[model samples]
Target chain A: MSATYTAAATLPEALAALASGARPVAGGTDLVVGARQGKAPLPDSLVAIHGLAELRGIAETGGGGLRIGALVSHADLVAHPAVRERYTALADASAIVGSHATRHVGTLGGNVMNASPAMETGGPLICFGAEAVLVSESGERRVAVADLLTGPGRTAARPDELLVAIELPAAAGGSCYARLEYRRQMEIAVVGATCAVTLEGARIGSARVAITALTPRIVRVPDAESALAGGDGGAGAVQAAGDAAAAAAQPISDVRASADYRRAMAAVIARRAVTAAIARARGSSDSVPIPASPALHGADRD
Target chain B: MRYDAVLNVNGTDFPVEIEPHRSLLSVVRTELGMPGSKEGCDDSECGACMMLLDGRPVNSCSYLALQADGRKIVTVEGLADGGELHPLQRQFLAQGGVQCGFCTPGMLISAKALLDQNPAPSEDEIRIALSGNLCRCTGYQGIVRAVQAAAAEIA
Candidate 1:
C-alpha cells in the first residue's frame, strides 16, 4: 500500500498528473481489486480523478447525443433518468455489472477500458455507436468504441491519453442489452448480446447486433445485420438474425462455459434482445424482459 | 510517497496521510480504528467492506482512501445514534439477522441505501439491494424479514 497519491483538482491538473507518470484512478473497482489479486502491483504514482466533478456526470451534447463523463459510475448510469429513458441498453448493462457495491464503484469508463471480452458495457457501447473521448497534454481525440479495443485487457489509448468521456450518438431505435450469467450476483457473462433496431413502419429499417463472451472481444455480427435488414420485425426474421449471430461467434472453450454452449446462447440471447428491442422501438412495451438476477432453477432442473 | 487527505466519516473529518495503494477500508480500520467495516474479501467480491460513499453503498476495500477526500462516508460504526441503534440495526438484532456478524455491517449499509431511495421497497427489491452482501448464515431469511419489518415500521 505504499505509493504516491495525487488528488487532481482540475482537468489540467489531471493531465499534468498523467504526464508526470501518475496512473489515473477512477472508482478503482478494477485496479484496486486487480492489485489485491496480484494481477499487478499498484502503479508507483497514482492520480485520483474521482474528485473531479468536471469529469463525473451525464450531459447532453449539442447534437442530440449523450456525453457520459469518464468518472461516471455504473450506479450513476443506472439511476440517471436520461440513461434510463434514452439509452436503456446502457442502463440494463450497468445494472448487472458485478453487484450493487461493485456497480457503485465501477465506472463506465473503467468498464470500457478494462476491455474484457465479457465486459458488459462493451456490447451496448458498440451497438449504440458510442465514441470514447481520449485527452492528453497534447490535445484530444475521439475513437469509435468498436475500434478502441486492441485485444483482451488492452485498448488503443496511449498511456498519456486519458479517457475523459464517452459520447453516444442519438439512436432512432430502441436498444436493450442481455447477458447470460450463472449466478444472480458478481458473475461475469457466459454470453451476452446487445441489439438496436430501427423500424420503418413494420419492417426493420436497420439493426445492430453485438455479442460478448463469445469471442476474444465484443464484436458486431454483420451477418445478423444482413439478416435483419429490410425484413419485417417478425419471429422468422428475428430467428434468422439470431442464427446468423450464432454462426458469427468464435467462442472458445473456457472454464465458465463450453464453446458450443456460448455460441448457441449467443444466438438465443441475440434473438431475445432484438425481439425486445423491436418491441420497445414500436412503443408496444415499456418493460424490458432482461432478468435482473439469475433464474431460480438451472438448465438441468427443467 | 504519501497523500494527505481528509476523510469525512460519520459527520466527522479525520485528517490522515496514506499511500495511494492503501484502501479506504484499511484507513478506516487501521488509521481511524473504526473496525465496524470488516474486510471479508480484499477484492470487491464480498461486501463486508461496504460503506456509504456519498450515501451510496460501495466496497471500501477496492476504493482508494485518497479518492474519498471531500466525500462523506458512512460506515457501520456511524449507523448508531450514540447509545441508540439505527432502525436497521435494531431490526437486524430483533430479527436475528446477525450470525457471524461479518456481513452484518455491509447488509445494514446496503439496506440503508435501499431504504433511503425507496422507503417502501418490495421483498424482491430488498433481495436485489442486499444481493451484493452475501450471508452464508441465516439463509438470508432473517435479514430479508428484518428489512421488511423495518420498512413496515417506518411506513
Candidate 2:
C-alpha cells in the first residue's frame, strides 16, 4: 500500500510524475497480477491515471470515425453505443476477454501497452487500421497499432510516454474477431484472428487480416488479404487465405501450445475469422467463435 | 510508513491505519474485524479474496484500500440481510456448492454478478463467468448447480 501522489487530472501531470520514475497504473488489471506475482519492480512511486477525464471516452471523430480513450475499460468498449455500431468485432472481442470481473478493470490501453503477443484486441485493432496516440514530455505522436507491439508481452512505447487514445478510420462493411482457446477464460490466447472486409457491389473492395498470439508480434497476413482480393471470395477463397496465414506464421513452441499445434490452430482460426467477417459484412450476428461447454476444449480442470 | 484508510465493510464504515505496503485484505480482516473474504493465494491466481466494488466483483487482496476511496464496497459479510443469507448463499448450501467452502464467497459474488446481468445464462456462460474463481473441492458441479438455481429463482 505504499502510495505516491494520486493526482490524475491531466496528461501533463502524468508525464511530470513519470519523470519521478513512478509506475503508471491504468486499469490495474494486468499490472496488479505482475505486482502480486512479485514480477514488477518495486514501485519507487505510483501514478494513478484512471481519473483523467480527458482520457476516458469512446466518441465519434465528427467524421464517422471512432476514438477510444486509453483508460476506456473493456466493459465500456463492449457496451458503448458507437463501438457497437462501427466496430462490432472489437466490442465482441472485448466482451469475451478474460472474465466479467477482469473486464470491469482491464483497459484497452493496458492491453496495447502490455503487448501480450496473443492479445485479442491487437488483431482486431490492427486489422481495422487503428492508430495509437502516445504522449510524453516531448509531445504527441501517432503510431499504427501493428507497429506498436515489439515482442511478446512488450511494446514500443517509451517508459516516459503513455498511450492516451486509439483512433480507427472510417471503413465500409464490418469486421469480426475469432479465437480458439484451450480454456474458456483467464487463459492466454492459443490462436487468434481478425478479419475486416470492405465491400463494393458483389466484389470485395478491400480485405484486411491480422493474426496474433501465435507469432512474436501481431502479424498482418497480407498474403491472405491479397489472395482474397486478387481471387474470388467464393468456395476456395477461405482455403487460400488459411494457407497463406499458416505460411505467414513463425510461431515457436510454447507451454500453451506447440508450434505444430499453433500452426493448425492458426489455420482454423483464420478460416473461421474470415467467414465470420464476411457474414458480419453481410449484416449478421451469428458469427464469432461461440464455444460450447460440458464438452470443452483442452484438458479437464484439476 | 503508515497509510491511513477508511474501510467500508458490510454496512459499517471504519477508520483505520496500516503499513503503506499492506494489502486491503489486512485492513478488512485484521482492523475492521470482517473475515468473510478469505485470502487463498494472496496472489491474484486464487479468487479467495473476491468482493464487490460498487457491486462488481474484484480480488480485494490484489488492491489497496486507497483504490476504494469514496466508493461503494460490498463483501460476503454484507451479502445477507439481518442474518438472512442471500439467495445464492442458501442455494449454495442446499445444493452442496460448498466442499471446503474456502472459495465459496468469491464464487458466490462472481456468480451473483453474472446472474444479476443475465438471469438465464447457458452452461457455457456460467463456466465463463466463474473462470476467475477456482475451487478444488466439489468438482464445480454443485457450484454450477447453485448458480443455475439462483438464476432460476431470480427469473
Candidate 3:
C-alpha cells in the first residue's frame, strides 16, 4: 500500500516527486487495478498527476502532426476529429480499448508506459512513428515509441522520468489496426496487426507492418514491410506480407491462446490489416470502419 | 498514512480522511456512508463499482480516492430526486431489467452517463455503454430495453 500520496499541481512538482522515487499515477486504471490483481504491489509513495493541466489536450503540431498530452484519455482520442479522420488506425485502437468506463479514465500515457505487448495502441503508435516525450528534473528527451517500450510491464524511462506526451508525425497514406478478440468490449488483443501503407499510383511506395501479442515486444516486421513495398498492393503481396509476419512471430502459450494458434492468427490478422490499409489508401474508407477488426471478419477466407 | 480530502457527491460535499490505497468505491461506501455502489470483481473488469467522476463514468473500484479529492462524484443513490425514482430506475422496473439486482446500480449509473452524452442512443450504443457491467442473472436483454426506454422517456 502507498504510505504517502500527493497530487501534483504542476509538471515541475510531478517531476520532483518522481525524482524522489514517487510513482506517478494518472487515471489509476493500471496502477490500482494491477495492485488489486496481485500483479504488482502499490508503490510506497505516489503523486497524482491527473489534475495537471499542462499534461492534457491534443494539439496540432508543426507540419500537421499531433502532440498528444499524457493525460488525454482514450475516450478523448476516439472523440477527436483528427484522430478519426487522419489517424484512423489510432482511433481504431483507442475505440476498442477496454470498455466505456475504462476508456473514459484510461490514459494513452499509462497504456504506452505500461509496456504491455498485447496493448491495443502500441502497434498503431509504432506504425505511425510516434515519439514518447519523457521529462525529468534534469531535462526533457524524446524516445521512439518502439524503443520506449522495453518489455512487458517495463519501459526505458527511469524512475525519475515521466512521459509527458506522445508526438505523432504528419500522417501519410492509410493505416489500419486489427486484432483478434474473443469479445467486443473489455477485451485485449489475442493477436493483432497494424499496417500503414502509402500507395504510389497502383504500386505501394512505403509500408510499415507491426505485429502485437506475437513477440516479446510489439515490433515492426521489416520482412513484412519489404513484402508489401514496391508491390501491386494486391492479393499476392498481402499474402506474402502475412506469411512474413507469421514467420517473424515468436509467441508464447498462455491462457488466451496457444503459441501456435497465435502464430497462425498473426498472418490472418496482418493480412486483414494490410488489405484494409490499402483500401483506405485507395480512398475507399467505406471498405473498413474506424475499427477494422469487426468489419474485416471473414475476410481471411477470401 | 491517510490523506484528508473532500469528495462532492450528488451535489453534497463530504470531507474524508482515507488511505492512499483505498479506492473511491471503498471511500464512498465506508466513509461517505453511501453503500449503493457494489464491488463485484474489485478489479475494473466488472463495472459493478461504476460511478460518475466529473460527469464521466469510471470504475470506482480502481480509482484512487485521493485522486477524487474535490471532484464531483455521482453514485447511484444520487440518481433519485427527493424520493422520486429517476427515469432509468422506473424504466428498469417497468422493463424487467432487474433480476438479482447485483448489477443494477452500476447499470443505472452507466445508463445515465450514456444518456447524458447521447440522448438518442441506438441499441448497439446502449449495449456498448453497458458492456462493462456484467449481469449474470438477467442476461442483459432486459437491461438493454430499460436503457432504451429511459432514453426515450427522457428525450
Candidate 4:
C-alpha cells in the first residue's frame, strides 16, 4: 500500500515529486491493473500527474511533424485528423487498444513508458523514427524510441526522469499495424507487425518492418526491410519480406501462444501489414480499414 | 496513510478520508454507501465497476480514489432522475437485457456513456462501446437491442 500521494498540478511539481522518489501515475491503467494481477505492488510513494494540464494535447511541429504530449490519450490520437491522414499506422494501432474505456484514459506516455513488447503503438512509433523527450528536474533529454525501450516492462529512463512528449518526424507514403488476436476488444497482440513503405514511382523507395510480441523488445527487422526495398512491391517481394521477418523472430512461449506458433504467424501477420501498407501507398487507402487486423481477417475469407 | 479528498459524485459532494491505494469503486461503495456499482473483477479486464468520471467511461476498479478528487463521478445509481427511471434503465428491462442483475449496473453505465457522446449510435458502434462490459447470461443480443431502443427513445 502507498503511504503518500500528491496530485501534481504542474510539470515542475511532478518532476520534483519524481526527484523525491515518488512514482508518477498517469491514468493508472497499467500500474493499478498490474498491482491487482500480483505482477507488482503499488509504489510506496505515489504522485498523480493526470491533472497536469501542460502534459496534454497534440500539436503539429513547425517541421511538419507532430509533438504529442505525454497525456494524449489513445482515443485522442484516433480522432485526430492528422493522425488519420499522415500517420495511418499510428491510427491503426491506437484504434484497437483495449476497449473504449481503456482508450479514453490510457495515455500515450503511459503506453510508451510501459515498454511492452506487444504494445500496439510501439512498432509504429519505432517505424516512424519517433523520439522520447524525457524531462528531469535538472534537464531534459531526447532519446530515440528504439533505444528508450530496453526490455519488456523496462525503459532506459531513470526513475527521476519523466517522459513528457513523443516527437515524430515528417512522414510520407503509407504504413500499417496489424496484430493477431483471439478476440476484438481488451486483447493483447499474440503476434503483430508494422510495415511502413515509401514508393518511388513503380519501385519501393524504402521500407521499415518491425515485429511485435515476437521478441524481447520490439525491433526493426533489417533483413525484412532489405527484401522489400528496391523491389517492385509485388506479391513475391512481400512474401519474401514476411519470410525474412519470421527468420528474425525470437519469441517466447506464453499463455497467448507457443513460441513456434508465434514464429509461424509472424510471417503471416507481417505479410498482411506489408500488403496493406503497399495498398495505401498506391492510393488505395480504402483497401484496408483504420484498424487493419479485422479487415485483414475479413479479406482472408474473400 | 490516508488522504482527505472530496469526490463530487452524481452532483453531490462526499468528503472522505481514503488511502492512496484505494480504488474509486471501493471508496464509492464502502465510504459513500452506494452499492450500485458491482466489483466483478478488481482488475480492469471486467467492466462491472464502470463509472463516468468527468463524463468519460472509466474502470473504477483500477482508478485511484485520490486521483478522482474534486472530479464529477456518475455511478449506476445516478442514472435515474428521482422517481422516473432513465430511458436506458426502462429500455434495458423492456428489452430483457438484465439476467442475474450482476452486470446490469455496468452495462447501464457503459451504455449511458456511449449515448451521451454519440446520441445516435449504430448497432456495431454500441457493441464496440460496451465491449468492456461482459454478461455471460444474456448473449448480448438483448443488451444491444436495449441500447438501440434507449437511443431511439432519447433521440
Candidate 5:
C-alpha cells in the first residue's frame, strides 16, 4: 500500500494533481469510514485538502450567491451565521446529514463529488440552483449541480476532473431543503426535496424544486413547480406541489426505502420543505432547524 | 505500510509509525497509552471513540492513524488541566452523566465541541448535536443533563 500523500495549497494545484492521476481527498470523513469498513481501497495517493482552510467557509459571494467551499463541513454549515440566517434550508439539511462527529469532518464537496443519490448535499443544492465548479489541468468549467449526478454514487464528472467549489444561486432570499430518513444520523435520505421560492406580496413569483434519492438522478418536477408558482404559497399549494413532485418521481426499490414509501414521503417532505421555505421567505429568519426542543439521549443498545 | 507521522494529541506532538490497518483508537490506547477515548463499537456509529480532530469531534475507531498526520487531535485524557477536571468532566460526574461510563468520553468530546462553538445551545440543539454518540445505561437523561449542565458551567 504505497500511497503518495500530497497536501494541496491551492485549488489550481489540486486540480492539476487530480488531472495527473492523483486521488483527491477532502476531510476524508466518508471515504475514511468506508475504508475502515473495508468497503473501499485507499487510493495509492491521498491529496489532502484539509490544510486549505480557504476552501472551508460560507459567505456571500461577489456573484450574489452563496459560494460554499469544497472543505465546508456539516458543522460549519450549521454554525455559519450567514448560512443560518438566509439560506437556512441548507443548514437544516446539513444538520441531519450525519452525527455530530461525522458532520464535523464530512465535506460538502466530497458529498457532491461522491454523488450518492441520497447525498446530503444533493437536495438542498438543487433547491438553491447550485452549480458545480470543476477544474482540470486545462482550465475550469461550471455545471449545474442537478446535472452532476447520474445515478447512485455516480457523477458525470470526468475521472481527471476535480470538483473545486459549489455555487448556489441566491434564490430571492428564501429556500428550504428537507427529507425523510429512517435514522437521524446513520441512514441515507429516503426521499429528499429542496425548494426555493420568491414571494412578492403573498404571491409566488418563481419556484425551483429538485428531488433526490427518489430517482436515478435528482430531477426537477416542473409540474410541481407550476403548482407552487401562481398559488398563495399556502398549505394547499405546498401539498399539491408535493403530491405532484412525488407523483413525478421515478424511485427504485432499495434497502433504505420502498418505492411506494419513498413516493409517499417524497410528497410529504416536498410539501413540508416548500411550506418551510415559504415560511422563511415570510421573515422567520431566526427559526430553529430542529422539529422539537426535547432532549433525547442515547442509551446503550448493546 | 508503516510511515512516521507527527500526531498532535492533547496539545503535544508525538512522532509515530503505524500499520495502515491500525485504528487511531488502538494507537491512542496502545501506542500512546491515552485510553480516555474508548473503542466500544470499533465502528463509526458509537461516540465512545470520539476525539477532537482539528477542534471537531470524530470517531477514532473508524479513523486511520495515518489520517492524523500533521493534524491536531484531542482525547478525553487531554480534557483536564494540571490534574483538575474539565468542567464537562466534572459536570458529568455531578449530574450522573456517566451511568455505564463507556460513552462518557465520546459524549464529553461531542458536547465539548458543541459548547466550544455554541456556549448557550438549547436542549434540543444539544440532543441533535450529540445524537450520534450512544450510551447504553441511564437512558441518556443523565447524559443530556450532563451536557446541559456543562453548558451552564461554560457559560
Candidate 6:
C-alpha cells in the first residue's frame, strides 16, 4: 500500500498542505519510480504541487537574469531560445537527460531536488551561480545551488520547505557541459564536468569548473577555477586546469568504474568541457551536439 | 481508501475509483480493461508502458493515476480510427516491425509521439526518438523502416 495524496491548487494551499507533513511531489519522475522499486515506501502523505500555476514557467528577472520555475520541464528548458543563446551549458545538460519521453515528463526542480550526485544539472547550475528559492509556512529563503546538497540523496531543504524556483545570474559568456558515459544516450554520467569562461581581452577574466559523479557529491573545482582565471585560453593552460580538477576529485571505487579510472576520466572530461566553453566564449558555435529532444520547427513555444 | 477520479483516455473519459499508489498503467489495464499498454520493467527502464499524457509520451508504469486526473491520455488503442489501422501500424505490419509483438504497442506509441512532433524525421532523429523504447526482436531495422515509411505517408 502507498500513502494518501493531495493536490494543491495554489501556493498557499501547497504550503498549508506541507504544514501537515507531506512529501512534496512535482513531476513525480523520481518519487514514483522510487516508490515502485520499494527503495522507500511512499511517505505517509504526498502533496502534489504540479497543478499550481504559480510554480511553472521561465521568466526574465527584472535584474536581467532568469528565474526558472521549479516545474519547468526539461523539454521546455531545451527549447527555450533565451536559454540556448545564453545559458548554453544548462541547455546542454537538460538536453542530455534521459530520453525525449523522460525529458517531456521530468522537471528541472525535480532534478535538483532529487539531489543525486551524478545529476547532469547540478554541475552546470553550480558553475552558472544559480540559487534555489524555497518556501514554507515560515516564509522563503534563498540558498546557493552549491550549498543545497550536503550528501548523496540529501539536501539542505527542510522537510517543510518547497523549492519554488531556481534563479540564475545573467549569463556572462560561453559555457558548456560535457559528460563521459558508456552509451551515447539514455545513460547515467560516469564522470561529468561543466565550465563557464569569460574571456577578458586576450586572457580569461573569470572561469568556473565543476565536476560530478567523481566524488561523494558534485563540487566546484576552485583550484582549477583559480588556475585558469588569468591565463590565456590555450591548450597548455587548459591542460593544467584539468590536472587540478583531477587532483581535487575524491572518488570511491564502485560497480560503475574504479576510483582510479574515474579520477583519470574526470581530468579528460574537464579538459574537453573547458576547451568547448572557451571556444563558445570566443563567439564560436556551440560544440556540444543537440539531443533532438525538442523540435524547433513547432510553434509551441513560450 | 479509494478516491474517485476521471481519466480521459483516447478521447473518452472513464471515471474510476483508485488508490493513491495505483499507477496509470494499472488502472488503464485492470480498472478500465484497456490493455493496449503493457507493463514491462515497471521501474521505467522499459518503455512497454509508454502512453501520451497531454500530447507528450511518458512511462505510464511510473506515473500515478491520480496525477493524471483531468489530463488527456492516448494509449496505443487510440492510434486507429473506426477500425482503420494507423499508417505506422500498417507500415509495421508491412515492414516486419512486428516480430514478438510484445514491444509493438510501446513502439507504436513512441513513434506516434515522434511523428506528431516531427512529421518528417531523419534516421538519426528517429533512432534518438525511439531510444527509450527497446525491442529485442527485428533488430530495429524493420522498426526504423516502419517509422520512415509512416513519415513518408504522413508528409
Could you list the chain B TM-scores for each candidate?
0.98, 0.93, 0.98, 0.98, 0.96, 0.98
lDDT of 4 at A157: 99
Model 2 chain A: weakest 10-residue lDDT segment is A293-302
Q: After superposition, how far is residue A101 of candidate 6 from its true place, in Å?
A: 1.4
User: Which CAPRI tier for candidate 6?
Assistant: medium
Off by over 4 Å in 4: A287-302
Q: Name model 5 segments beyond 4 Å from true.
A: A10-13, A286-302, B19-23, B153-155
lDDT of 6 by residue, A21-122 (tens): 888887777888888878777777888888988888999998878999999988899999888878888988888887776887789999998988899899
| Overall local distance difference test of candidate 4 | 0.91
Off by over 4 Å in 3: A286-302
What's model 6's interface RMSD, roughly to a tenth of an angstrom?
Answer: 1.8
lDDT of each: 0.86, 0.78, 0.90, 0.91, 0.78, 0.87
Q: Give one digit per residue, the lDDT tens place, for model 5 in A155-225.
A: 88887787767887755757777777655665467788888788878888888887878887778889888
**Which lDDT tens digits does candidate 3 get at residues B1-155?**
88899999999989888889999999899988889999999988878899999998999999999899999999999999989999999999999999989899999999999999999999978987788889999989999999999998998
Model 1 lDDT per residue over A1-302, tens place: 45677778899999998998789888888788888989888898888787788888888999888999988988889888878777888888888888877887788989999889998889889988999999999999999999998788889999888899999998777888888886666777888998888888878999999998887878999989878888887878889989988998999898888999988888888887787788778875444336633245221200
RMSD in Å for all candidates: 2.6, 3.6, 1.8, 1.7, 4.3, 4.3
Which scores better on TM-score, 1 or 2?
1
Model 5 residue pairs with clashes: A3-A44, A299-B135, A299-B136, A300-B135, A300-B136
TM-score of each model, paired residue for residue: 0.94, 0.91, 0.96, 0.97, 0.89, 0.95
- Candidate 4: fnat, from 0 to 1? 0.78
lDDT of 4 by residue, A8-52 (tens): 989999999999999999999989999999998999899999988
Please give, as one word, the docking class of candidate 4: medium
**Candidate 2: clashing pairs of residues:** A1-B20, A1-B21, A2-B20, A118-A213
Which stretches in model 1 have alpha-carbon errors above 4 Å? A286-289, A292-302
